[model samples]
Target: MSYFWTGEGGVPGDFAYGKIHLFAVAALIVVTVLMCIVGKRLSAKNKRNVILVAAVISLGFEIFWRGVWIGRGVPVLETWPLYPCNLAGVLVPLIVFTNNKTLKEIFYVFAFIGGIITFVYPDGIFVNSVLNFSILKSILQHTAIIFIPVFEYFTGQFKPQFKKLWLAIIGLFIHLFNSEYLPRYFGMEGDYIFLRSGLPFVIPGVPQVLILGPIAIIVMFVFYAALDRKGSKAALRRKKQ
Candidate 1:
């Protein structure tokens, strides 16, 4: 139990597919669906407020978690918010509060992909027991990452723009640069975005993190295209009436 609160325990070993992982994923799906339904039912003003609250809570936890790591003597560089998921944590509040359409579009695609992948195949934070604070926090944080943008889409607050794919790519470049160069310059060993080596489950000789951005963008484009095609068919049907 002290290990849960205190970061005194050694870092847990690599994640293996397990029952807890499945339960966490299932819970995320349920929460996401419920949020979408409630968001759709809410008045526009209230929906925005809901989003604001979610963003605040998500960012707050992220900062708190980092503080815990730092207090426990973890290096600041290693825990910097440079990973795609951590970057999303910072961006969510900006998107929700400022209502920046461009940022929202950029965050939506990246968050959706990153959140899904992280939840599905978690690392470092995964625990055999659900009672662990790390596991609970991981589940909640990733859920927010997946849910907020999806809720926005359901409420018509966001529209997919394939051109914004460039924004995600740019964000990736910034992370990669920091992960690669900052450590060498500072004489510290840090793997911010895991650019040097992929996640635990990744096969050898594959640049998983490097390739993930382009793959995510392509997937988003295909999803947008399918939605557009469906909308076109509906419009044609209505026009024929």
Candidate 2:
């Protein structure tokens, strides 16, 4: 029980990519699949409501996460919410409440891809126990992150277009700028969006972002293109019917 709230040192059984990790990933996959299937039937109002609910939940978990870190004696400056997943608190709500197509397109692809990538890699919270605060909050926050844009996509709230891939590029640039500036300005240490130390397997000397960032942008473009194609076909089919 003590380890559940412990945040100072490494806890016991802090294994990543192990049984609990895989189980969590599997459960996320199941939930995502179910949401996709069922979300199609939701009304626009319902979808927007879900987005708002997700935003609230994401905000709550985000606060809880920061409180945990603050309680651990980490400096308030170092605890700045600059991480990508942290956007879930604000962006998810704006996606529904505003008419900002740019925000919607930028975040839709980001949330979907980023959420899945983190689950596959378990982010940085690698506790073996599901009961641990780190693992529990990580799962909950990412779940809200995954749910918001996914619900938006399935319910026709956001139809991703290849042309708007530029929006995602812009978002990436913002992350890159912060990845460099935030750590320096606040004396905090982190790779941000894997731009600093690189991916899970950090290279000996290279900051892999220069290489991986463009590749990831290309990957996001491809995904957006494929989704656009599917959305087009479905729309055409409905028109014909």
Candidate 3:
């Protein structure tokens, strides 16, 4: 049992890869539906704002980190062959219960617990220790970012602050800095950092540490700015009640 639990066969990626038929994602779908419906019933615009921010951030992180960096060869199919977990697990619940501060707190609490369980437990559930840190970091990081804006949206606590350029720039810097120590310490490949190969113009070869680092920050800022703009609009709409 331990062998089946800890060995290669025990991990989620090993089992779930390409096997589009699974129950977990379905469970996420069900949770999404319930949360959205219930959340709407108890709704406040502020709560909706929280969820909206969460949804956008969730999508941004997934797209930039998961889809672009790792799944390089795969085409960005917007709709089908769907990977729905992030939307379901993170966004839907966030939007639904953003008004309920307790619920939001619970979600983050459990999210942190889930992160640890998924990574450290090694009990045949999931793998990818390399990517896991970033994923988990995003979860924690975005929890803080998404919460204030979202809470404000529903509560009419403040006006929507639209600083796309700064938001994007900060996001880019944060991600670059986040990646710096992890890859080196873990001895993992820095394939996601851009143009060690593939897209040459984006990140050139030089003092890789210095060169790629700033470029990565710039690229991330561009990507995040777009996402932040969308979120700000959504929050404003929710704020107007």
Q: All models: lDDT?
A: 0.71, 0.70, 0.40
lDDT of 3 by residue, 1-241 (tens): 3333223332335332222212333433454455545554554664555456655665555445545434545434322112112223443345344445433322322232233333322222224322344334333433433333333433443232333344434433433443444455655555433335444344444655466556545644443334357765675688899
Candidate 1, superposed: residue stretches over 4 Å from native: 7-15, 127-130, 198-217, 226-241
Candidate 1: tens digits of C-alpha lDDT, residues 1-241: 7876753465455554666677878887887788888888999999888888888888888888888778879888767665667767667766788888877765666677778878766767664443466676677777787888888888888766544546656655665676567667778776766656655546577777646556655766665555356654565588799
Which pairs of residues collide in candidate 2? none
Q: Candidate 3 — what's its lDDT?
A: 0.40
Q: Which stretches of candidate 2 lie above 4 Å from their native place? A: 7-14, 88-90, 198-207, 230-241
- Candidate with top TM-score is 2
Candidate 2 C-alpha lDDT tens digits along 26-63: 88778877877777788777766766666666776777
State the TM-score for model 2: 0.81
Give lDDT: candidate 1, residue 100. 86
What is the TM-score of each predicted model, taking all chains together?
A: 0.78, 0.81, 0.34
List the RMSD of every prediction in angstroms. 5.0, 5.0, 13.9
Which residue runs of candidate 3 sit more than 4 Å off their true CA positions? 8-22, 43-162, 181-241
Residue 43 of model 2 has an lDDT of: 79
